[model samples]
Target chain A: MTEQPTEGEPIRTGIVGLGKMGISHFAIVNAHPDLELVAVADTNSFLTSAIKRYTKVEVYKDFKRMINEAKLDAVLIATPTRFHFEVARYALERGINVFVEKPFTLTLEEGRALVDLAKQKGVVNQVGFHNHFVGTFAEVRRLVNAQAIGEVYHVTGEAYGQVVTKPKTSTWRSKKSEGGGCLHDYASHVVDLMNWVVGPPVKVLGAHLNSIFSEGVDDAVHAVFEYKNGMSGQLTTNWSDTTYRKMTTRISINGKKGKIIADRQEVRVFLMPGCEVDGYGEGWSIKYITDLQKPVWFYMRGEEYSTQIDTFAHNIKSRNTEGENTFASAYATDEVLDMIQKADRARS
Target chain B: MDRILFGDNQFFGVNHMSEEKARAQSMKFKDTAAIMKVIDVAYSEGIKTFMCTTHDRIGEVTDIVRDNPDRYNNFTFYPGMPYAHKYANAVGELGIMGTLKKFAPGSIISTVIRGAMAGITQDAYELMKMLVDAEMQRFQGTRTPVVFLQNVVTDLLLGFNMREMFRAFHDYVQQKYEAEAGFFSMNMPMLVDVLHGEGIENPIVCSNINKIGFRMCGGIEKYIDTLKTKQFRPIAMSVYASGAIPPEEAIKWVCELPKLEAIVFGASSRRNIVGTRDLVEKYWRFDN
Candidate 1:
């Protein structure tokens, strides 16, 4: 479609980490009004087409070019998992805002650097863990707030089918040295979800195994966590299974009355733990979705590249953005993953 | 003397990323080097007949600015650019690293006509108009009329389905542009010579798949019909196509033709030149 300006307008944006994701992100900038995909600086030739197609935009096969020529309002980073820190730091140093893809920064320490930089620059920033807004998750939030499932007891999150089918050859996706593999690639979502519902984890003890995409990155992982509220949970993510494979987590809680299972589509609860569930002991009954979030569920892949880039376009009109996708959400997610990696999976 | 000349047909091998690589590799310089290498070598060999001008425009636009000349230096410069004087003079005068400041923009136009592709947008047309004006105003009307050593100029005038395989005309130009430009620039060449019965500079030319229906035109002689159709003329040249005809046999037949000037032969290595030169001396059927 044609998005024309009233003339003499500048839509400044910066993109980092030139990869497939970054290229697609450039498409996001391309199709947005009030958005000029100004400078694309990646360590590789990832955004060459992006730069040319959006003519008059500056490009850097290196980060320094983004810093130098493009006076950007915001920067989106999709770099090597490790390079995320340095590139984000550089953009922040330039006072450019940021939109980073997940695994926010490499380490918590690096994450802190970005947080500090964002604060110091006084610019708005967000991370792309856009899936939180899709599917029954939004409904999951509504149901919980409405107390549709009662008290939170035990949350079981399962993420599968990440590494069971290997991509041909190797990409940045297959390296632990670069935050590669499934635990970081897919389970980073689960960590975000856990935080979204349970606030934060008090302690996380996890064990991981590598089944495929064996560049020493974890593809299979099991984790159990204790929240500060004396509540506990068990969650597992596997990249080695397919067929019935997908991203699904059943968060069931037994409050004073019954229990509920909130997945991507619908939230189901046995009102008395006796009627619907086959193995429910006594007070089990089926309670249909009392409330559902109004978004069209984006199954399989996030709806047309997820996060319905429209909100982001409208976000351009606002001064602040808040959600599971806010920079706070990203930093929080990174903190959890880094903690889990260090405590549960980092060991050789 | 039969006015014949040599032209490389498979010059810059077309370089659009095949669908196979869509998933495996991101299109990048390292990936596109195969086509780039050929262009670099094509110029070093002094075979100036170029069918794609956008490729040359790219070299002159961005590469040299970054202190990257080794890549663009292998070929003689011939491109059909929009504005040669402004682009060349600006890039050349900018004296910035990674920019194309040294190449002569005027020489660009004399290399190709309307790129290897056609369909000029208003912006492109404007770019051409400004190019001619800027070239004349800046260099004092000293701009060289540029045209790529192209295929049937007359067939293009005749409309669709006239030239076999020429349907890929736009694509051929894009291939040259990508290969020569190191694969990023997209601007196409402008056709400024059709109705005026005009010719591009450096009359060296080549005929590719569009060689049928034109009489006495042996193996690939059909393209000559377009030139005849355009009320056009060319310095006749024979090229090495398909199997081995030996350089001597190829040159002899061209020399026997009414206006054949020189027959171009491709070489894989330095040793191949010896056989080509031997054939030229022993069997060249020149008027001399």
Candidate 2:
């Protein structure tokens, strides 16, 4: 087991990868009161050198050497998807807490192995499925759990963005094996949101992956899901939609007594005449993200990012193994992604 | 600062309330001239200050104002620094070294050498000064009475508990640019307290101060308390909560707040601009 820090002592932390998300996480981690960012590792010399020049933290070109030398109590992994399993496993084996970015692993087997290893080590582990911390989305889950929308019959999850409008050079995102496509980068968020608000689909009834702008990778994903209790849902995600200025994820739930439509900004609820939910009235009620959100200590991009990091820090401090966005929970999402891919391949 | 400062969100397709509206505005203002037309309208309506992000396109707008001194004689620009997406896009296209070489203010050799020294000394303030100079490059030949640190960087520094950077920015802008340094943040209460602790009296801090408390961190009550008790010049943005509140109610409520130094709003058309300006005028009087 890892040595726990004394109460009030900061958690010694190390981070691997210096991509866009990595840099954002680095900022947040460096600022967190509970985390003392000790070291950072990145393969890109320019990024590492720039970070070294700016911050007092140690920088290394090799993550393994950094992890070995930094004496870190925890590690945040934001590397490309294919590297997740190996990096996470290496940390977990050392009894170090791990926080891996979303699309937890490239394959289901890898995700399962990491989840099992994390459990065996009894470490505080989390996946960066940030939407679970969004106020509007969290409210949706609460209302659904409260059965505010009684006897849920159907749900629809959608995400669209203008990630790639023109033909671009190949980055890690354009490579399917490197987790560059919409199915992994964009659709994973929608799928995880759906899983969090509603339940994960037990069966993938039908699925199709389309490539609108990139080669060898899917830019759009359409899938139909079936729950064990006979509820059904659909997911539609397109990263090539130029109409959107940025990524927008929305989930609509229709039930016998009411309906709920939620996005990153707000959540709208409709209840029948007799249906009742606290703080919400019948017919229609709108709740904005501003009213629902709690004040984060540090907010960049969104409160959810900081919230997730804070939660992870708290879990590590309290040694709470099972928490929001755990390794097991992310592994379940990976299973659904696998099923969707298999269904799409069988049809094609 | 102007009491009713104009904002640049509408011209840049940044409607937080509605994506459809944002997309429509993006389409409508694809040309720089279209944006200039709206600015002309706001100017005609007596809103003389343009509080804008340092987007690349804004460089063109500044150029227009710089050239036609007769048209924009009394106009002022409150430029917020580090339009973060610009840097992100630059890093994506150009490697980190290339991005620094391209955007750093001084000669390339000096930039790299100073960058290394700043790293060795762990001098974040020196690096921050360089970035401030880089972002302020486009505002040359214009009347920038107040320069703002964007919410992204301000809030990040607030989280990092780096109060020295805030002071550095405040002092640097005053000494270097002859301008008062403004800060845009999501958490006004915390920022005000930090600045107050740093002995920066009556600092200029802009945040989302609206009737509905939209995007106002620390809740509406804490914000009210800060306004009532703190000694900071408050500039209210997102006054309508991205159209969630009607112009009449939003202006009425915000104008009633204690010591609200300014209100920054954005609109695309003459009608909306005139409408908001009239409402602000009805509630709050501008002596100047």
Best by TM-score: 2
Cα lDDT computed for each candidate against the true fold: 0.47, 0.86
Q: Please give me the DockQ of candidate 2 compared with the native complex.
A: 0.30
Residue A23 displacement (Å), model 2 = 2.1
Model 1 alpha-carbon drift over 4 Å, by segment: A1-10, A46-57, A164-169, A211-213, A244-256, A273-301, A304-316, A321-324, A345-348, B1-288
Off by over 4 Å in 2: A45-54, B27-34, B63-67, B89-141, B157-180, B187-203, B211-213, B218-232, B243-260, B268-288
Each prediction's DockQ?
Answer: 0.01, 0.30
Instruction: Tell me the docking grade of candidate 1.
Output: incorrect
lDDT of 2 by residue, B85-151 (tens): 6665454434344466567745533544444443432344566778888788899999998999999
**TM-scores of the models, in the given order?**
0.49, 0.86
Model 2 TM-score relative to the real fold: 0.86
Tens digit of per-residue lDDT, candidate 1, span A12-76: 77777656456556654654556676677754331243244325556677777766676666678
Q: Chain B alone: TM-score in each candidate? A: 0.38, 0.92
- Model 2 in CAPRI terms: which quality? acceptable
